[model samples]
Target: MSSARWIYLDAGRGLAALVVVHHHLMVFFDHEMAALIGDESLLLRAFRGISEWNVTAILFFFFISGWSIFLAVERLGTLNGIGPWRLYLLQRARRILPMFLLSLLWAGGLSWAGERNFNDTSFDVLVGNLLFLDTPASLRGLWFPPFAGNGPLWTLSNEAWYYISLPVFYWAVYSKIANPLVRIDAALLGSFVVGIAAIGVNAILPNPFFLFATLWPLWIAGYVYGTSFGQTPIERRVIFWLGLMALVTWSMALEIRSDTLRILSDGCILALCVVLLVKIVRWQTQLTRLHYIDGIVRLFGSVGRGSYTIYVLHYPLLLFLASSRTELGGLATSLLGMGMLIAIAPHLETRIYAHVNQWFALDRPRADA
Candidate 1:
């Protein structure tokens, strides 16, 4: 949480937030936009890559999350006992659960009131979402969610699991166990076996392992970067960035297999992120200013702070807009949802943070710290 790192992360978060918001908004316009302005237009061509990769920014969020969670856990002090884990969970519950549950409730209620209802949402799916355990058997489905209301919550649900397990990771992976019979090496070996078993089980009941099995590696990269921040050399990082860029540029020219393209593109993006984040973080003073370019960054950072709120609210807004105004409703809803992120998101975040933290006595820093 150094100033430099915060600025970088905030900037990234802001950009991701903007992309995701517009991506969701533009979904209403997906077919229309292409038809209204034919795909041949220069403007459409210009934004093709960005438009395609809009949701990919979720990877960046995960990358930043890995780093941030590590800092928070480390800041909570040593994992001498279960104390750190308890503090981690408490802080997480205080910071995340209340806002998310409240928002989920808000979205669900609105959806039920409107044309849509969770009549199809099984009890397990409902409780899974309510508990932020969307990976439960009841919640599994075709890729992405079948539920429309608050669809963006999938990422948050993944993150909740990540937060809960981070402390276990730090304790079992890095530190010495109190019992000598099980060392870090043994713990890691056991984990590897467990991972394989999980994957096997996922092959049967895929829902159980989808979130933890697939995404943990990406999250772990963040932890690695955070813990080894100073160890990465400047030359290597710069070289890696340049190499990645060149490779990407070259790869785009060639038509590769779908699986290859996905893995290479996503893997490289995640790898580049790790390099960029771990490099020496220099504070961008101009980022905080109100000048035109700098102001844009600041605005992104501002919106980034409330990105989650914006995310949750957008789903309901989309539904409401679609249901209420069939004619140009998408356009109207898009603008209104984006505008609300700017005008009301901050206030909502502040009030919710205060009320929830106070009620749960989570306003203070970790007691371990």
Candidate 2:
């Protein structure tokens, strides 16, 4: 791995992955939570507000993935020794496919035990998911009768689809477009413009899920913005403040079913992407008394080494917990549960990948320096 590249992208992925965990925590933990928040208590109101806007976290993943992939290609291309494509694909297969398949079985089993009628009607959709074709339709139901019942899988499918298609997309922008800088500029400008247009169109058609399709352009925007605009000191600070402002503004705004607000929210997410990208480039993290927090981040990053497993396996575990309803000792219980999953997931994920590689005969590739 390129040490410089690894430093930021790994750290960014670490943040994005944690956001995913936090987003899910809000979902699973929020039960009669609105009532618990006393009318006058600002703290409880803030907590409720964060949980309601949890979807934004997944969008962060999409943007980061785009930026990271572009940089990976750029660096590897410059180095001239690494087989970027091979390395990328091997890692992708190891990280994504095994866990995805395992989750299918796990979810299927849970469905059986719970006596929840698993509709196999959308066999085509299942196949689509199996191949990541479902990504473009990520917000839609997985199976006709909502067989899997895991909303997160859609993003995974979207992620897989992005990985599968990125080579062609990268080549188009980086090679076929003739001027890399120009293409990057267009991608950056076009994503927000098109995103707003999409929102307008969706308002007429009412595709709440149509926004999932924006993942592609949002990602490409990050890629373009990173490649074309180097992280200058002033730019970094500006982007950080802009991102923070957007987050704060969005948090303060009341919910209104207006396309304008949706567009603004998307823009805010774009800004946040810029901030995170700049932060990684700066690498100015101070080691405070948050050693435990640091350790948790480090642990999650390691488990994120095989996050595909955790992502895939986690829903079933959560479903079981939800279904069983065995008394978890409140907020502490939720944290502990997530902690245990983080601890075990990495090891099990690696083992599962080993078997997957063997089964697929994927271990024979010689790493050509």
Candidate 3:
């Protein structure tokens, strides 16, 4: 992919993060916002409509994550053995865990300072969150809510499982079992056992396994797209058909009452979005050089690099500000919260992660080494 395409991808991700931020701001201060801007105001109505895009934004995150992970694994070469898999896990952990743990601490501190009893912060919940067992309660299973009301943590659990699954999937696909039929049977049987186990787990313990299983295909779609990106020439007609299908699925998602079917529809929508994003990047690459557009894309790229920090930390900060009973208007408070998050995100995500990586020697090995 061209550098321009990479920048555009980053811009897309950054824009998605901003969408999530806007949605949460709208939700967190809905009453205050109604008071500030009259309840019937067009602006307020528009904000509410925009807030509904949070789900799509999150799905975008999932698609990009899969694409990035595919690139990461390819860059690392084959995970043919246990050592490579361990290293991959370590690297992923280094990138993800520090900020995640810090966010938990931040949320806990905010809850304590605010004296808010709204969230479950007990030891079991903390452990569950740390273990990435926090899933939506609608999944028909025992589930742990996000600790201290950090609702976004649910996506992190899904992300972590996807990370872990990629290596396993790679290993299985590239395994030494040479017989194709035997391999197929093994894969199917293993899947069957896992499904049964997941059913049992849902009946017993807090189960995030099932939720991840449901969304796993969306990630796989992205990985497939990434692998075929430059090699395959996609026609505009194909994209149109995919978009049409996405629309149909999305409408079905809205009209259906079944949670599982709705999730499947959302997955289809996200998979289609991945294809659209690729087309968008290609289109951007063909455009004439526009300095203003380039500058804007670069700014968003920077934000995208820090997007994880924004996702994990924004809610706690917003909650804290909201709970403080400050004299600032809702708009001012929301802007302040966003500003603080943007300012701090790059430092926490890049600088702090770099420092932690070096301190722990978790950096990927040099190709020369």
Candidate 4:
């Protein structure tokens, strides 16, 4: 990765994480939320109008994930052998599991200490959380919200599964199939068809069990984004924009009569938004002369480097802060959580995730230089 080219990406990741933080932090402030309800400022009104409907932050994350997997493909040159796939899975696990276990232990311990209910969580639920198998939507049907102490981590299950399945995807979509057009065609067709099947299953079954089926399109789109990243072409982005608009228009055309269709349409829009976001930002940074904007991006990018840890650990931290009722109150405590994350990320990343990721890297010889 060219540092200049990817600064926006890191900055974007950081910004997406910040947005989620800000949204959750606002949950602590009754007055602030009430003010939004009564807000008259046009700018704030517009911000709320978009922000309220924008579930695109997490969607962008998945896009970035796909892109990341693509980079692995480019450098590693596909998982043609079992040994490469084993290293790939090991690297992913080591990168995620250590810190994940730390957070889970902390949260689980706190829950038991506070409630004196060590028996509250069952093996399946705990296993599901540890493995990223259970989602809030899925657990909600079973009346198991409390077990999902860190709700955001639920997406990790999707990511984990995606990571595991990526080699197969690499082989089927990009590797074993030599024809590029055929690969894209197969991916698009298979992903959408499976996604439709998932929607049907989702209609009848509890969510997240078939979550991958529902979100295959978005992940594939992310893969496309990664493969296409930094290729300076206007038409690719233009096509993505058109596809996004078409999905939005189609959703509106139907007026959201069926909930399943509504979600599928939303997923399509979100997937495109992910691609458009990276594309537009990269384009902007390239065209702009503003040094200050670059500096700001660098700052956010710095904070964003630890965004995953922040995202995973924030829920528990927020809960602790709120329950402690520090003189700082909710908003300040929430902000404090951000500060703690920024401070902690460098250490955790250097000592943990980055090292593992680097060690597991497939194209290390080329990357090291």
Collision pairs in model 2: none
Tens-digit lDDT string for candidate 3 (73-161): 66667667787788778777876787789989999988888845547789999999999989865566546888888888888888888
Ranking by lDDT: 3, 4, 1, 2
List per-candidate RMSD values in Å: 6.4, 6.3, 5.2, 4.6
Please give the CA lDDT of all the candidate structures.
0.58, 0.55, 0.69, 0.61
After best superposition, candidate 1 residue 149: deviation in angstroms?
3.5
| Model 2 misplaced stretches (Cα beyond 4 Å) | 4-8, 32-50, 71-94, 115-125, 131-147, 177-180, 190-212, 225-264, 267-273, 276-300, 327-337, 356-369
TM-score of each: 0.75, 0.68, 0.82, 0.80
In candidate 2, how many Å is residue 72 off?
4.3
> Candidate 2 at 130: error in angstroms?
2.6
Candidate 1 C-alpha lDDT tens digits along 1-369: 445456556666767776777676567666656676787887666555566666467767776777667666777776678776887788877766666776667666666776645332555556667666554232332233423346667777767777777776766666755532233234323443453344445545656334354455455555545655544353344334435443653375265333223433474466565565334223243245425646666767777666667766666666666665656556655676668665787567777777766787765432110
lDDT agreement of model 1 with the native: 0.58
Q: Model 3 misses residue 204 by how many Å?
A: 12
Candidate 3: TM-score? 0.82
Summarize candidate 2's per-residue lDDT along 1-369 as a digit string, tens digits.
Answer: 334444444445555555567667667666534445565578666766665544565566666666566655554454222377777666666656656677777777876675344434256756656755443233322222223665567666656656666676665455556655456444444554555555556556643234444445556655554564444553444454445545643663355555344535665666566666455634544433435645655654675554555556666656655555546544455566667877777577667657767886655211100
lDDT of 3 at 265: 60
- Candidate 1 segments whose C-alpha is farther than 4 A from its true place: 34-39, 116-122, 135-148, 177-201, 233-268, 277-296, 326-328, 364-369
Q: For residues 1-369, could you state the per-residue lDDT of candidate 4 as single tens digits?
A: 644545565676777777766655655554555564556767555555545542567766766666556655565544667877887676566656766777677677655554334333676777767656666543322223324366676667777778777777777777667755456566666666776677666656755657555666677666766655655563375344438544653655396454445655766776666556656766786788768877889888886777777677776666655556557565566677767776887467555655555665532211100
Span of 10 residues, lowest total lDDT, candidate 2: 137-146
